[model samples]
Target: MKNKYSTLCYQFKQLLNTTLCCTALGMSSASLASTHSLLIAVDGLRGDGIENANTPHLDTLINGTWAAGYKAAFAHYAQTMTDAAPNSGPNHVGIMTGVTAKKSGVTGNGNVAGGNYSTYPHYLTLLEQSNSSLNTAYLVTWGTDMQITNTADLKIDANDAVNTQNAVNIIKGTYSASNWPQGTDIDALFIFLDDVDGAGHACCFTASDDGYVNEINDVDSQIGQLLAAIKARPNFTHEDWQIVVTSDHGGRGSSHGIHAADNYTIPFLVTSKVAKQGYLSGIPRNYDAAPTVLAHHGLAVPANMDGTVQGQNIRQENDKGIDHGLTTYLPFNSNYEDASGNHTHAQVGGGSPELRANGKFGTYVKINGKKEHLTLGKPSELDFGTDTDFTLMTWYRVSGDQVGDPVIVGNKNWVSGANRGTLLLANEGNGDDFGINIASSRSDRKDIDPIDYTFNGWWLLVASFDRQGVATLYAGSPSGELNIIAGDISNVGDINSELDWNIGQDGTGRYHYNLKADLDDFAVWRRAITLSEVRAIYNNGHGSELLSLMNASH
Candidate 1:
């Protein structure tokens, strides 16, 4: 009798579990049907272009909430060489692999003739992971030739008008669009528009760049067509949906390549099945484009990916949205004229970075490779860990003239008689490793973990010091991931020394030096920036793009 009772109970529990799972599935289907996601990359869109053009379609996009903008920090980013060389291979690899060209071991578009060169460490698109369960497909134009075919189930050869119309038909409620792959799959579609970057290169970024503008308009019209198609499709309303659209890089000198502001800037946008969330700003790198689909389908982001969730901010969020209140009001660089009457940007911390040492305001030396002194700017002080929650942000273009990276130090009171003092952070040249100094003395050292920055051509660096003196440095995403690509995990901000604070100076007395690049948009906050805030930086609101179009030549 006892055995029978136990058996009965086990069977009952199993039956209950099955019923619950089925019920969950039903709910998911209802939401999933409405939750269709699309990721789009508009080749060569600039943050500054939005302000000067008639981008009504993008204008409708809100700069926060479902989508936010964030700036990216890359050393070298460009569009293409020529019509025959319409290759953004490294950038495309950055997208599908979520790893930068440097990190994924795929450095440039192609250094050879008629072949793909992205195979040192084979990259896995988020699609090949758990997202396999979902119907994932990549549709692209000429830009796809760079690398999309080598990544996943991406198509290159297709009739543009027909394929677009077919996609539109599927988007609308028109009998599920007979041409689409059949299944109850949670589909994530990614597409790219090559006309923007391609045309932008031929034409400069100005009112005269009508060809690029019209191309964007054409993209908008097709998007509208897709919207209409989805609305017409049967059972389409039952699936959940999200759409992400962005660009790879912009143009410079009426062309692209090399580490120029125009060539490195791009666009990222996302729209949920419901609600028009608006513009997302400040997207970090081209690689951040994929993790949305991967994370959505419950796949882990590859350890090597430099992408961030800020790419896909569209969610099924209802009721007033989460309170994403993170703001930092620090000006990057004010206007400055040189001795030759030529214009150039000043060191950002303060205006001119010129400080009076012996009671003279103009008395200052160049700490960061600048020939001029910087005043009216925030001086970088490394005495941290005092604030309960502090975050630092800066936009910098490192010139190749780098002695070494200056590190932020802690434990001020120990090193100096006053609060504390920081030693210069430098590569001991002992090897390709980095170690921290407690005192200005090399012998008085507490060896930190070895870091590799040989590949840091020029990227934005943001370091956050949490409460417990546990410091984490972020090269790409501020709140995205601690490691940019496949980098380091040293307790960077962890300082327990009684030292004084310093800026731009390293252990060897070298400065926080870098050559070949421009820097701007420096900020610091008292608290951690929420995910929503990260999205805002990607849009046109706060830090949508790093450089200003007015200073395009700079």
Candidate 2:
């Protein structure tokens, strides 16, 4: 019996060894790896051009969780000697090195006469320096991009077609296998498509011109081919790939270099499992790609880089509060609940408004179109004393298409009730001129330029009044960016602090017009918040989660 048991154990051990040997023979180096990345840069692509181009491959990325949608990035640069216009050389360098041309000293498209990559080490340099074994490659059409990085293992100045095939071959172990031991040896691969830029230069960027659109469509097809090749790799499933596609800068007509909005705005799309789906809030600059790529590989961003890893980093930074001068916060979700520590609870009066769940962040209150209103109970905290700085913030969506004045929030004099609060006056006098009016003080009133009325969409409204009686109104629609309106106050005197602080109704002593709007995240600050801070709130609901706590209170 002992001899029989020993023979069975030996047979089992031999079978296990054979299985292990077979597994080792079949598996590649990437099977045990964590992540890989592919960064593609398209030169001279416009923000509006993609809207006309049929890019189904890019559409998948934009509608998915990885990308933050259109107009997701900006090229922030002033005209300098090195880059007088929105040049690709400096912009691509910025994307690779994570710094602007001013800091990196690589100012123009022409290569530096006597310069080593000392000030601005390319992203590839950072990657290779961090991990010597990580394979990196850069395939570009322009020769100037060569000076940006010194650490890329393979640098090929080939056409987009050849580069695409080379990338596939590298992944398939056919091209330069001596350097890359396995088919999937490359860790990071960058491919530049210059056809679109060439097309733009050849023919003016007319939307009707097939030449320009055809180039974009052609590049999209090539990208599809590259994606197929990567997927077909033997060890594709084992490796995690973060695909990022973006443009260096946009162009106008035949030229691209200028400080205009059309030239600076470009499309940026990224795909990964952990990315959040939506328009990236705040503002994404061109240089953010380098840090983001570095972050994907679990590499630390060097302190020297100017750009930040934005999309994923926002969540982490959000955990730590960015409330610089947050005073009174009333997240209208659930109820007229104030999230700020200050007890500025809403006093429901005109009608019994109920909480609904279709709000931007959480739940919002439904103010009936009749005479419904909610007034802030404590007036001292909201009313900035005589000539004091103040700002009003809220997110609301109009339900009814009322042509009359829709008073969102009001603080009027108890005596005269002249228009001394914030009101969204739609179709007031004009058929479609929707404007905002704010009475800063008892007799002082400021009128903002009218915007075309929009309904059924969430709108962010911010009205701020400084001590000097200058008023600024910023409004952001659901899809559109923020719009600014500035004006001076007329009669800057004592504010009527004792009056009722109202929402969804014009409580200005005389008028009782109610607003049929879903209001949420209403906040009032003692001091006027900066424009950047206002933009932050509009881009990403920076502190809207406090509304959950407000909901819990109910």
Candidate 3:
């Protein structure tokens, strides 16, 4: 009996070894060799739209590469009803330069010589090292990347289309698949789409939502053609042909911005021929990706880079907690239920919670949870002064299936009813059919359409209503702040003198009422705290005592 068992064990081990060998061999074929750049960009793809579309080709392809929703540093392209900055030229430059907008010293779209160039490691390392032998060229309009001077060395800048067709045409004339350069290893073929941006600015997402979406789908189809060409080649293993699709910055109505949600978070998608083998996984910050790409190309990452490289020495920084210089709500420690498991709140999936403190004293929860979280209610409220620059902070978790309204309560000066409170910002599941609604006492204020907040998982919601009388909402900390409407309302629309703002909603001011989600440390302030104050509050949430408790429980 013992001999028979030993023989069986040996057979199983042999099978496992053989399987590993086969798998490694396969990985080497698609990955070990150099990959050809088959990059594509689809404008205005909401982070929420990633999984819903019926586009199976894209769904599968996305799984093949490093994927993430990047943080848009400065979201310009402001709007009439905007609550943030309006022009995002400087933000775009950061992407091309592989640096933060602040570090790059770029705040708008301009080719000024002093353009911020805080060099991103991935762009330089990938081109200079891994694919060092390959020739790279780009075709993009004026915006995010102004560094593309007309060097004439395999580069095309479309400052004026058709009008400058002579110049652009000359560059593309060399792109004939049949007649390619034999000596030069053409590694990357980057393409940028800037038309939808115009639509967002002229029509606002309200009227141009369909147009914006259609434009993206159209670009996707065009990319499908490019993918087909790469696949038809002998050297290309379909998987060896790397396809990356992303935008330098997000868009909104009337203006671009840095502080808007749409402006801060950008889409990142990579589809390789060797998918199914499964690609890199886990939710990483936007900055982390540049380093990851650079590493894959066998290049060294710069230490000063603010982003991260996944699956490496770089760990996921918890900006949500105190350790990372944040304050406010408790660092979204971990998902928990009642000790007796009887609080009755549903389990949240596909999304997590983000924590933030108003460096002074308050919390902001960007609640996007699909299900309800049995959390602490608005047990407290304070007067966030009328003449002060105040900021609101909260840690919210977005539902994987929806972006629900779980925040937005009224104060002494809200709602028409003196005793009424409006808790807006919850999920209708179907779409933005629901939202968080807060009203002030006076009027002349523009109805702010929160620059597209995250509908997927979690992020810190930071509201900066400057004393200068403008409001801005940020995803994480005030890495960037946008301008929203912030003046006293004159009764016609101001609901400031309402009742106790409810989280689940009592059907007060907006379309959303019932909050099927959880909320924590919902706080207020008398004045808008400084950015550093916000960081301190974030840090406070994850106090040594609290972290130790969280870790022990985990």
Candidate 4:
């Protein structure tokens, strides 16, 4: 029997999901049953550092969810007093509590003068409270990681191998029939590995260092052993298990705690039957881990959990999708300057990202079908991580007589096969075809039905992609709007930080897919804007109207 509050909480969550689904076309409505969630944290491991190591098992697991890479999210989130310290204390606390260290009162590694474990609630505590019968466990190699544990069912081992072995036993129900029944299962389990961090501190943190690389390999091997053990379980096939792996901050040369990118970045991987295989689209922070696991168990994340659910937005902030996470909004009101607060300046060339004006808005960029583009070199703001959802929008009128593919906006590296960021091309050979190349290991293009845009009046083109590889493309005409499923493609890839993104031309140096049309109000959002939001923008009557709505909403 559930209490009224509990029932209301569940109902409220469902209501939120329903309201959100009504807004976005590509938004996922899939729900997971309350199942087991296993979170493994590798301390002090760099996000990119795994690329240089021999981690066959870890690599194999990542392939099932994120393709082939140790690519990752940020662990050294600056939302706490730790700032860029990247210490295990604050990171692990954030991972377990879903709150900043500042709020959790676990500011530094050592116990705060008056702060106790009860200062902030752990996600496990909340989950257990939601369902008392749900089993939970925490295994760590560092004593400091124990600070985040509020439950008595905790195990600590400084040795990575022993700690993992113990975790394997616990999963196998070998810990004890009383704590873990043979037929029953653990609802949630968290395992922390510290060898990689130890190796980094002892022998240089660089990937080239044999000691550091070897430690990573060792951990990977242990992960393989654990997976094998779980598979050997009698109920393995029947159990709906989800495995999430990440780290407690990355390291620099020999130490961390700096505000550098290398020190803050860490790998985040999820392997499960329901998991999406690609790079996540959002900027995952350490706090997101707790909510992600909680959501996997079909539990409503508490309002205090300061993190984004893996596939769902717990806050429902973008339900309306007016421009929730607007990164770059190039309204082209008068110039090529970005209206989005990021102030991402565009460089005009040939036909110019800064070009001929006159549109529903004050001015527009006109691509003259020549070797011209607007380039933004390595805009870090555009690097929506692997498996993260994002939405792209632009209003444009195409020229009918185009000799090659006309790209509204795209990255040059996409043509070079890097497939970072997004390359939106339409009017291929003619003004009817529309295609998109998402960031992936290889450029996998998804084609939508040919909607003749050649010489067509200004139309609002909105495309959104989610972690599940589902893409929805919308073509909003003055008369009416049409949309189509763009088909699923590899969702695993990151923006090529080494290259430049452009507008009105392909990333290829040859300058193919030039935009031969009038463009206005080009915007990129970190989140996948819903269909209702797209309709709202189109229904606003004019470009300025929509712009005002977006500005006002944001």
Candidate 5:
């Protein structure tokens, strides 16, 4: 029942995935051998704790100094489940099953029994189901933390020392027959260290706590032993191994399960020859671990999983076209400076918007609905006259339903009949839609059909107008699926206006339609970007690093 276009798109997506997998593995699809993955979960490991601890082994993994010479780990200050308590049970379910507490039905440590693990089994179980010949092992310090399905070939619940030893034994193919079937290869292994969490509960959870830091240091030593064993494998050179290290949650004052940053902020790290170097371009979550492991093995991530592949946001050759005609770019990475190098810096107009550390791409500006706005002061670069092709794009996430139709970005008064220039508005006409309004005058306005939008999530919105008076609107989901709608707007005359360019509100003195949302990566192009360029900027939900794309040779 599918159309030709849809079928072709699906085939293209599959081809792209295969190409990317082959490139990452440095082998053809048919030549790829059994890949291996080691997932290490350090309970209550804060992002700052890693910085404070004396962990040389972890440092090498983070900095990509391993014997295999893999790329630097994609280390990120990721968050736990935002909607659920920052506790072990919920977070572990997320890490193992790639689902949030809402879907897993495990809201806290006390009610892990209520989880839907059968429906949403661990990634290892999924892998086994896909390929029964593959072997997997799970070793954890806490017996009660057995959230994963009993599908792994070997499951060991013991103290940190025992678990670490068993992990090393399995990696070296020296595990006893009584512990694990001899000669069985572990394609996927998960190790959980709980002593750090115990140390946090015993005293303080901050990095200043000597006991907590020491416990982390001890875990690092265990990790080193496991890494050495992996390197000692006879076929280690032929095997593609990916090591992922992350934490369920952080703690504060010997307790956690709160919404505070100290409780939710944790570390997500991945070290592999195929992994992209340096930090992830976007905010990562604990749930991303499962899909990341699955993707490393060239397995398809289930559509039901909420997590996405991590550390694979490498720039492709198609991304080089993203910088074409780009005139203004606002990364909002702790600043409002234009990354496009046009010097079209933003100036604070009303109350200052807060610069949030965890944005979709680096830092983002949080705008309160109450009078907070930013202005570009009518830069000539943003002035697109009629017949001049232009494109406006931004990534935005609204906190919730707004009290009024909010203007996300515009360069006009936006008054009907007096409207000039183009603007992107959210919840226009009190509807659950994003509207793109392009007008030359009040009577010569053209409004594209509203596109449905979601709240409390990142989305990319693009409005491109061609000299032929054709306007195209694209709404991109976090997963890189784009919904497009286009209309002919040749009826409109000049869209150039003298009004100052404004973000999160209309630029005029009338502070109507103020946006209550987080905004990042706002940009403007002098010409309408191609559809492929739009996809490149979206970057499969990782979003593009504008400067990197701009500097890349086409």
Candidate 6:
């Protein structure tokens, strides 16, 4: 068995090397030749619409039973743009630009012309700017509602039938126009169909509606036609093709742009030789399409984009059991509610901590060093007996002004030779060190060497305790690097006390040290979490909520 220190070092080194290489090269080093992507956006296609309509092509693609010997597809009942109106312009911009309305400035269909498209343009435009040799095409059925066609070598605005036929002609290398008498090679293509949304707006938007179902069926047939055309290519065997199908938003009776699930839930599907079979690991957002497309072609996803590449770095089946022993989880997303379903909510005392909108994962609680703190009343589940293994972790951002010893989390008094519980402190015998103090009784306390702290930055602090009283502390930086310290505290037999559990100050109130920092994603587990699980939660500085980890594992 590999130790935690060596395993963490190896993982960090490998990740750092990959990051450096990708940064220096400006593109993925695994770029392949003759690769192509066909992204299809079917407007207002609900998750149930596919199941209710006759979509053999979609079924075959999703089930990995394509007669042409293609690999299985990755399907997801994904969510639309979050915290934005469920409108075509905003959702479409999110789908093509990998950003929400907050960044893209396309709040609705009427305001698309005034969007920030120049700064956060479509992925096709980025690709053209990065590599002009790669041919790109854009075909939309709703006229010029989409303003991202500037960089496409072939841009078309027509009805769904005309656009589908043009895409097929392009695939077969028989396309010609007034500007270019000869057809050009196509590498990436985006097709937008709006008839389904039109049908919904005309009448009702339900799976039971015949008009809506008929439009879906027609689109499925069009998709079938496109697939057949791809397989019919003369050099099909030599070309790698990826096909992505999704929708902007769903709707209710003749209307949308609401907060209801019917308007926000949509279907997302991806089929290719290298795609993952069956459903995606987690629920993806509409904005993830652009990054996914860019990553498929070995292009770099720009830092300005807000989307994450789907199906990348997914947790393996064996590692999905990370949440088995999770006892308490505090997300601190505008509240102190416990997300672990344990109901161990924290109570505010003294002055209420300010809830800030920006955090490592979500909203965080801001603590000013002046006596403000949160108290988690003594819960029996948190009291680990003599030899039970446990893990405690939290993400904190220091304000850089430190006075004396401050407690990040503790359940006992911090009196010398009288402590009786575990406390993770910001300073241990020194000003700029993070350490843990575990004690079963007065003389049984143990304080290990503290890890150096960097102020004005976010860091993940984790402490795992084994049945043998051996403790390991892990400090993770924003750069994906880790510093670990281990020590034997077997003399600290039962580090459980009757005092209440507190955050940002000592529980027993003996020490007036209050932590001046922002905190988020605090959790406790009955069993010690493995090193890989720690890395999964860390997620290379983009910390994940517990629910996301659970969903990925499932």
| Prediction 1 global C-alpha lDDT | 0.40
Per-candidate TM equals 0.47, 0.52, 0.47, 0.50, 0.55, 0.53
Of 1 and 4, the candidate ranking higher by lDDT:
4
**Model 6 local distance difference test score:** 0.76
Task: Give me the displacement of residue 169 in model 4, in angstroms.
Answer: 1.0
Give the CA lDDT, 0 to 100, for residue 372 in model 1: 23
Model 3, 56-97: lDDT tens per residue? 446545433222211111111111112223244443433344
User: Per-model C-alpha lDDT, please?
Assistant: 0.40, 0.63, 0.39, 0.63, 0.76, 0.76
Candidate 6 segments whose C-alpha is farther than 4 A from its true place: 1-33, 67-69, 313-554
Clashing pairs in 2: 332-521
Q: Which has the better lDDT: candidate 3, or candidate 5?
A: 5
* Alpha carbon deviation, residue 347, candidate 6 (Å): 34
Q: Write the number of the candidate with greater TM-score, choosing between 2 and 5.
A: 5
Can you tell me which runs of candidate 4 are displaced by over 4 Å? 1-34, 65-84, 112-119, 177-184, 311-554
Candidate 2: tens digits of C-alpha lDDT, residues 1-554: 11223434534653454467658778544445346778888887765456557777666666562223212221111111123357887778777877777676655577442234676677788888898757788888876666555678778888888888888787665665343333335678888888899998998553445788888888888887777776777656656777777777766567777654446656556667566544443345567778878888888988988777744522111222334345778665556656677677787767777788867777778877667778774367666656667787778677556646666776663233343445544434344334556564545654554444457787787776664534555566676545443444435565554567777665542354456667777777776665545656776323334444334434
Scored against the true structure, residue 408 in model 3 reaches a CA lDDT of 41
Q: How close to the true structure is residue 453 of candidate 3, measured as C-alpha lDDT? A: 43
Query: Which candidate ranks first by TM-score, i.e. highest?
Result: 5
> What's the distance in Å from true for residue 365, model 2?
32
Candidate 3's C-alpha runs over 4 A off are 1-32, 49-56, 63-88, 116-126, 129-132, 143-146, 149-153, 158-185, 206-208, 272-289, 310-554
The lDDT-based order of candidates, best leading, equals 5, 6, 4, 2, 1, 3
